[model samples]
Structure formats: structure tokens, C-alpha cells
Target: MNDFLELVKSRQSDRTYDTTRAVEPEKLERILEAARLAPSACNAQPWKFVVVTDKELSNKVGKATSGLGMNKFAKDAPVHILVVEESANITSLLGGKVKNKHFPLIDLGIAAAHITLAAESEGLGSCILGWFDEKEIKSLTGIPASKRLVLVITIGYSAKAKRQKMRKEKAKVISYNKY
Candidate 1:
């Protein structure tokens, strides 16, 4: 695969991580660095990533996230990057009139995408978890009241070899502009 395509192709949801394996500090820093560089609306940069690598902390986060559909595999992953979205950045950028519904979460999505792809590049694995009790997460992680929890990204090294899951063929997803 070409470099870009390889980056895209390499990414997958890895839930079963080897408890013995871990992301080196330097590689983890590089991945977060990539996330830090993601583009944002008016450069609001309203996203905060709280990484949980400590087993006790992971359990706390996992306990707080247990009900979400995405949390199944997520609990096992060694670290969970809690993504918080703040409206203040965009609001401040726009000079006070808060026009939401499009800015906060969107900026967070961009950051999460960047983080995921960066992890893949480093031979690390990640899963974007979407379900969890927001209030519990905030309390568990000590996330402030002003920021909203957007996603819980589970990150760790893959315990097994890489393989493709059965998926719909690309021909079905591509379409002409008129279609």
C-alpha cells in the first residue's frame, strides 16, 4: 500500500490487547503530538485528552463506562484517552454569541480521527468508544463541568496479529456525484 493508503488501511478497532504489551512513552507522546496538531474551527482547539494508563485508573474509567456498547472491548485496553469538548474556545473565537450544534463535537471528532490514525502509524491500536455515562466519566476523571465528554478512545498495542474483518466491499459505498 502507498503511504497514505497504508495509514488508512492499517487502522482497525482492537479490543483485545495483550496485558503484557504496552505503548512506549516516546511513541505515546508522538501519537498525542499528532492529535495536538489536528485542525480545529478557527483554531479553537477545544479538545482535551485525558489518558488513563494506570490499571486502577483504567478500572475506574471502565467502571464509569460499563454501559456503553463500545465499552465492551474498551475496558480491556490498557489506556483510555477521554476526549472532552469545550464550547468556550469557539464561543470566545466568535466573540460571545454561542452558535453550537456544529462546533464543539466537530472539533473533537477531528482530534479523535487524528489520534486514531497516529496510533495506527506507530503500530499501536485504538478504538473510539461512544457509549458511557457522561456524568460519571466527568466525575471519575475529574473533568470540569464546562467540558463535555465526546468520546473515550481506548489505546494500546495489539495483542494479536493484524487481520481484516469481513466488511462490505468498497464498490457499494462509492458513488457518482449525481447518485
Candidate 2:
């Protein structure tokens, strides 16, 4: 998986994980560092990664992510990285207002991509989860209610095999000049 395109092709939203294994601290730290170095608009970096590694706490946070038959596998993952949305710097805020686009959300999305990709490079599986009991998770993690919890990323050894990716034809998705 040294090639960047191959790495992108190999990365998937792994649903099942090997419960007995734990992610190495060094690997996790490197993954966080990758995320920390993710580029942001105006270098605001308006996000915080709240890592949950303790068994009981991770399980609790995972449970908060499960309901309606979604993210049931989250509870089994060994680690959860909670993506907390923070306020952007004044320049980024003004730029976002001027452009009518929320840059922090985009910045956080890039950070999440770095996190999952770094996990994949480290031979770990990761899933970015958006559906969860935000208030409950915020309370569980001691995050202020005023702040938004954007995403929860689960990381661990994958138990499932990779499936061939299905995508639209290149012609349908790619264009030469204009739409």
C-alpha cells in the first residue's frame, strides 16, 4: 500500500473489527499527527480530536452511536476519535462569511480523511460515523454542549474482507471542461 492511489483504493468503511486486538499507541499517535497536520482554511484548524481508548468509556461512546440498526459495530471497535467542532479564527470566519461557505466543516472533513487514511496506512480499519446521540456523547466526553460534535471515527483491526468497489463509469463522473 505504498502507492497513494492504491492506498485510496484499499481504504474502506470497515464495519466489523477484531474485538480482541488493541490499536498500538504509537500508531494512534501517528494517525493523530497526520490529522493534526491536515490543511485548513486560513490555518484555523477548528477541530479537536477527543480520543477514547478506555474500554468502558469507548463502549459507552460507541453505544451512543448505535440506534436504528446503524453503527452497531461501533461498540466493538477498540478506539473512537470524537471530532469536536471549534470556533474558527476571525480571518477564517470573515472569509467564510464572504464566500458564504463554512470552511471549518470542510477543514474538519479533511482532517477526518487524514485520520482514516493514516489508520489504513498503519494496517488498521476506520469508519467515520456521523449518526449518533451528540448530546449524550458530549456529556460522556465532557465536551461543552455549546460546541458541535461533528464526527466519531472508529478504529481497530478489520475482521471483514475487502469488497470490490462499485462506482459509476468514468465518463459519467468525469468531465473535460464544463458540466
Candidate 3:
């Protein structure tokens, strides 16, 4: 398999992480660099990443997560990544007429894909979390009204590297020529 392909296959969602095993600065930098390179609409690139490394802050934010599993699972990871996208930044590029749905969230999703793959390549583990209240998250992060939080991610080295996640046989999902 190609290196990139292997990286993709190797990635898995690990709910358990080793808080004692801190991710190196260089590794984190590479992950951030990868996310920074993801493409955006008209280069609007309205996303901003706020990494919470402070344990107290991480736990505080974790508590705001609505899912019981999320609150319990969050503390084990060493860092939390807040994925935020600003509507104002997007509106500038989109111009008149704020559509029923804005595209910054989509753009943020693209960047998040980059981040997850990058973390895998760096031998780090991550869980993409999204069970938190928007208002609570905004208040916790002191984020502006224009910026909406799209997702949160807990990142660090996993307690154990579980085997690869098996997908449904590709034949079932793939279509030839047309679906």
C-alpha cells in the first residue's frame, strides 16, 4: 500500500488515550500544517483552530459536552482542538444573500479531514467529538458571535494502538460508471 494509503487505513477512533504521553511540539506542528493546507471556497478559509492544552480548561470544556461518554472520554486526551468557522469571513467572499446554509462548516470539515489524517501520519491518536452545546462552547472559548464552532477533537497518543477499522466490503458501496 502507498504511504498515504497506509496512513489512512491505520487511522482509527480511539476513545482511550494516554495523558502521560505528551505529543511533541513538532508532531503537533505537522498536524496543524496539514490542516492549514486544506482547500477552501474562493480561498475564503474561514476556519480557526483553538487548541486547549491547559488541563483545567480541557476538563472544563469536556464537562460541557452533552454526551456522557464524551465527558468521561475527554480527560484522557492531552489536548482538545476546537474547530471554528466564521460566517462573516465567508459572507465577504459569498457577497449578497446569505444562503439558507453557509459553506464555512463544509470548509471546516475539509480542514478537519486533513487534521485527522495528519494525526495518523504522525502516530498520534484523535477522536472527533461533536456532542457539545454551541452557546456553552462559545462562552467557554470566548469566541465571537460571527464564529460558529463546528466540532471538537481530543488528540494525543492512544493507550494502545488498536487494529485497523474494517469497512463494509467495498463492492457493496462502489458503483461502476454510475450508481
Indicate which candidate wins on lDDT. Answer: 2
Error of 3 at 116 (Å): 0.9
- Model 3 lDDT, residue 49, Cα: 91
lDDT of 1 by residue, 66-145 (tens): 76354665666778899987654645556434553566567788899998999999888988888788888888778987
lDDT of each: 0.80, 0.96, 0.79
Highest TM-score scorer: 2
TM-score of each candidate structure, all chains considered together: 0.85, 0.98, 0.86
Clashing pairs in 1: none
**lDDT at position 56, candidate 3:** 84
- Candidate that beats the other on TM-score, 1 or 3, i.e. the better one: 3
lDDT of 1 at 59: 71
How well does candidate 2 score on lDDT at residue 18? Answer: 98
Reference-based lDDT, residue 167, model 1: 72
Of models 1 and 3, which has the larger lDDT? 1
